[model samples]
Target: MKTRRVFLQRAGISAVALAMPTLNPLLAMTKSADPLKNYAQTLRVAIMGLGSYGTRVAEAIQSCTRTKLVGVISGTPSKVVEWREKYGIPEKNCYNYENFDAIKDNPDIDAVYVITPNALHKDQVIRVAKAGKHAICEKPMAVNAADGQAMVDACKEAGVHLLIGYRMHFEPNTLEVVRMRKEGELGEIRFFQGLSGFVIGDPTQWRLDPELSGGGAMMDIGIYSINGARYMVGEEPIWVTAQEVKTDPVKFKEGVDETITFQLGFPSGAVASCLSTYNMNYLDRFYLNGSKGWAEMQPSTGYGPIKGTTHKGPLTEPIVTHQTVQMDEMAAIIFDGKEAEVPVNGAEGVKDMKIIDAIFKAIKTGGKVDLTFG
Candidate 1:
């Protein structure tokens, strides 16, 4: 799959000189006093489109101490010789997808996660930020919001870091119910419901291809009820309204999508009632309400022991491995500039792709729509 003359022969130039712009030596290194002991002596990651959630993020980055899955970029050469003998890797840090921008001359790889197919995540995260590395991707980061803000302006004009898998922002009982609804204990908040779906089963995969899943089950499981109703109604929703219910229009063709129900409105007059489906089954749940009390989670965005309750009680919290604590808290928010209580960058994935473009423009203008995220 990788042949543009093996990416212009080891990227020896021109794809506009491997996308010009540069200068980001790990964002000029510095801040340390034990940046997790210098990011456990170097982060070193790599995996771009190996599929099955990139083998569950390379087995949860082997339970990441700091995060070190050496390298890989497969376009299937026997799945890159079966993940280079199951992750021993090396062979110039193995890559395909056309030489993967010569991994910018490989210094044993620093980052490049992308996991592919959400319309190829804005050109593989702008070619992993024009190959200067650091890019994480995944989630519904693109296929909208102008290709997720052109992959966050090509990783901020190539200074790097783009992150956005949003692994429930490092789940621990969903950040303890987003830190008990920001310590007010769900008090003045108003509403939220987010019931994400399931029940999809290969109607010819590539997620039922709307040109590789730009939409279907609301861009795959209704973007976990639109990013769990903006982190359980903490805010940011201006407006949106929608409805769609394709009972298999020949396997949800015409730009995909199947079963969607949305609403959002927030601005302290908070509101959200969502559902996204692919012919549901045990739909995951998340609920929040308040003027005084409420919170709930039932298999909420599963991929662990997430179960909950609130109005004070039963959250439990110690169930780890949501992609191994999101690659060890994204190696301390990319080498210790640390700051993700909830945001998972690329402008929090362009505010959930501008609320999935105002819920597909309020499902084609049946009304509501207005939204504005800064």
Candidate 2:
């Protein structure tokens, strides 16, 4: 059977090569049909927020054939100046947060990738949507469910695509597991375990501030587990039970949780156990158990180079920058109406936010919190 790759090879052949099968070599050197061609031509993007993650996103985008960074928005004037010079962006393409709304008038920037602090995502995404550009926001998506809904509503009103920075949605190995589950290779999923955490070294970072980051490990790092639970089990949770433990009030602060253990009960009779913390290293992993088989992903939800295995075999997918694949796919999604292998829409993010909210409520009251996504 001729796949798309084979089709591209045949399309590149000379008339003589069409007549011969065994010895034709010219077609082999021809480029496979570039799936990103249309996106590469149409997607002009901007990076909002020039922080560490923003810088890395910008750099990763340079490798994306489907997207180009044409503008920048930053609160820090010095960083804006440096970025404009570095990317060769015209003066008209630069903006500060206060003046960013004027971007609605610019035609060059087709999308805005928001990489600001957690609390700022709601307002910033609203503004970006109003500016008539597609909104690609960093994860947790917002400080809480309410803010996530506001962002979603704003984008819906503006008729713009709202994509959260769930890079694993585009990751090859991770998506393979999702494929396996959908294919029934995992049979009926009965149990799942999601673990995500890190020893956040800087006590002064924004992640520790409840107002800025929304919550402690649960907000900043635990979301990986939350999302993993949903995707691995392939069902929306019906209820949540949680417990919180904190050892350092100085570092984690009041109104913030240092560590949390939560359980999610799915409608399919599958249950997930999750652990989230701010005092562990290389702590991202997932285990899904099913009637016929099981899958395990260690170093699963981290930034890159994921390693894992399943009942069938080991994950042999090559390592690539999660951000690189994400940006390219985002470009295609906005410009060509391309759907993600797994949805990364704002609605999907809001569902996770609702689960997080339930988890927090469960911890506060020491009771099971019911959840329903309709």
Candidate 3:
């Protein structure tokens, strides 16, 4: 009866809509005026890193209607000057890493987007939380689960929102696939595969430094696969097993991983086989198979134009700028109480960190590591 009533109501609405062609002009005028309410609440953001990814995000933010880049936090003074000039940022809105705590007094800046190295996320995000502003940190939120939890606790205690930059969570093609899985367009999930990697050229960069990076390929490129597995399978992994392989000790060095192949077993008997590597190229892909249907993606987690196909046919979702959509959606989440389809909050980052911790332990022990997530 509930379904019948809903269907009848939809039919009535369709008939009214067809009959009310003249009403659309009035509706459009009303809709035009309604946008001013949302526009008035645009979020002012400060990005904390001046590196390549930070630059990408700053450029992407120019297109975001709901989120604006108004300030910057960088250790390099020269980059700060250049960015301020380029982005029309005022001197008062800028601060170096050592002095960013002063941002707490600046009411114009509402949030800080931390795009620094993996090891730096914990301290930086905690600081942002303590300043009584929201934090948006990049992936691999911390070096380990303990630090990730500490960031989560700090934000909770300070009463601020802590969001991880899981930009794919807002991507259209990715969301459509998740929607299909939830709507049973795909039946019970059986298996998933994620391959995320790239060849590293600069051996001297911060990404290769254990102190800054926390780990090698797994922390950098491998995280996408670990994150992708859970979202695609729609289940937290119960256990993980991993094996590591290193060819060049000179470049990779101690405490840094070169490549890892990990498996995640879910509670529903679903399993994931994934690979994370630094020496491999053209490895960005995700595949999911279920009892009734399958979806496959190549170049799955890249910056833009994430293409995919399902058992039905090609995924036809509109291609969108990932970072632009992400920031705008994040603005809604931080201010307007919007809930994402998959969580992009600090707890979600902690869950990924827990899996990474288990993966590293599994590599060292040559045994399976069990996981428990609430």
Candidate 4:
């Protein structure tokens, strides 16, 4: 399959060729003189779900330089009204799930950000693609690798972009660490330890439901460790071995994992030891070790102000809102055709899903599971 950047480049060439013959000399000259003028235009975005994370994302987008929250899609009528009034969304832009397909006719919306439950991502992303809009789906992207690939295919077929909401990919502290590792500051990377978890409050929440969440702590918080391992090591894992433990069987039922410790083996003989749990609090941290030096971050994946230190000194990157920077950078990706420093596309999401699939398989069989992204 052609990559998104290749597809965009090809499309851009064809578009330029098709428009050149019809362009008036004066208009062409004007366009050439200020090519960046139109590039600075705002990207109008519509948000789906309107849940807690969705609300946070909407608020964050308000701080974006080249993005606007112009529309909304929600199941509840009251939320639609509340969002419309608060965000200054028009009535025409507000839509229910059943009627959101009509967004194909609404030119005001450039993209739809799917911030709904994990299980709903596949269908909602495909629907967004079919509506002639770009898609920005929240992580974990989908319930499984197959679903994630389906969303990618749907967006590709529609000639639109599909971005996964990996906000940390745009985070300053995280990126600085990644940059250092890539610059060989970490030497030949050998090991990584990622501990990501949070205590669950409500047993009756949808996240506890296997059908809605796909899994338990692994699916929600554990994925951060999985993704961080991949990016921090800068390589695809060849195999995974995992073990699951549940202390509270009453709260975490069958198919819903409470705590999981997974290990990934890379082709370069590097290994990652990670833990994902729902019963633990303040477990967010990432540690990377290499032949020469090391880097560590505590409260790494938290909402804001991620702090870290390297073998040399402190990692002092400017702190910014993760979602806000993400939206601004996404505007560049969607409109200006800019490439992300760390990929956050559907393909990236699919790779993570593939790893997650392997981890689950490893846990189920109590053996090492070989991973193949293709």
TM match of model 3 to true structure: 0.90
Per-residue CA lDDT of model 4 for 224-304, tens digit only, reads 999999999999999999999999999999989999999999999999999999999999999999998999999799997
Better of 1 and 2 by lDDT: 2
Ranking of models by TM-score: 4, 3, 2, 1
Ranked by lDDT, the better of candidates 2 and 3 is: 3
- Candidate 1 TM-score over all chains jointly: 0.34
lDDT of 2 by residue, 159-277 (tens): 77899999988788888899999999989999999998888888888888888888989988899999988888888999999999998888878977889999999888999999999
lDDT per residue as tens, model 1, 193-253:
8888888886999888889778888887888888888887877888888989898799888
Which stretch of 10 consecutive residues in model 4 shows the poorest summed lDDT?
Answer: 22-31
* Stronger candidate by TM-score (2 vs 3): 3
- Alpha-carbon shift of residue 146 in model 4 (angstroms): 0.8
List residue ranges in candidate 4 displaced over 4 A.
Answer: 1-39
Off by over 4 Å in 3: 1-38
Q: Cα deviation of 49 in candidate 1 (Å)? A: 4.2
Candidate 2 at 274: error in angstroms? 0.5
Candidate 2 lDDT (Cα, whole model)? 0.83
